[model samples]
Target: MTEPPSLKKEPIGRLISYIHRTQQKRLSRSLSEYGIGGGGQYSFLKGILMTPGTTQDQLTCNLKFDKATTARSVKQLEAAGYIERTTDPEDRRSHRLYPTPKALKFQPVLQAILDEGNAKLTRDLTDEEEDQLIALLQKLNLEE
Candidate 1:
């Protein structure tokens, strides 16, 4: 027996694209109520919360985002009072990013939103399957 042409074609790209779109739509809707925009601001929030005092350049590098996009996201986050920028003592021209009290206060809510999305994604999988899927994803995403 032969598989269908669609099924026989590259599966990873389609699967990943579908998952990305689904998560983006759901997360955008969930985070909009908190005043976060449609882009991946939640990820940046989590990044700053986890690693305080990182600079905008660091964020751009760490997030693999372009300079302009990172700058825009930082500006939006600052405008919304979720993050603050302090002058980098080492580099007078650069500034360090930090999560504000408002962002810290809402961290749990943001985490819950992420957890809910993960749960939805894995709702049909068993614990072992979920673990296996995560392992496979990590393996595939490993940097050279």
Candidate 2:
């Protein structure tokens, strides 16, 4: 029997897109309690937390997000009291990012939540399989 069109045409793209959608929905729900929106807002927070004093441009480059998205997420995180932005002395137009005390206090909790989410997402895979899948996905990552 011939393969169905859905399975035959761009199957890899379709499957990856479906997985992305599913991950986004779950991340959105999980992060909603913390006032973090989806579409990698938490990612931005994590980046800032991990690298205090990093500039918005650095976040954009390191996280591979556009300047607008980095700006928007930073604004939201600052409004939520999760982060602080200070003018970079040497570079007047740039701002250095830092996590607020609230963010520092919530860091472990946030990590736990994200860890649980990853565990749930990969529940069906064994440890080795998960590692292999990650390696394979990295190979396909064109963002680099």
Q: Write the per-residue lDDT of candidate 1 for residues 60-80, one digit (tens) a residue.
A: 889887898888888999999
Task: Please give each candidate's TM-score.
Answer: 0.89, 0.89
| Cα lDDT of model 2 by residue, 1-144, tens digit | 987567346687788898888888888998898899977898899999999999999999999999999999999999999999999999999999999999999899889888988898899999999999999988895754
Q: What is the lDDT of residue 45 in candidate 2?
A: 92
lDDT of 1 at 4: 62
lDDT of 1 at 44: 85
RMSD of 2: 3.2
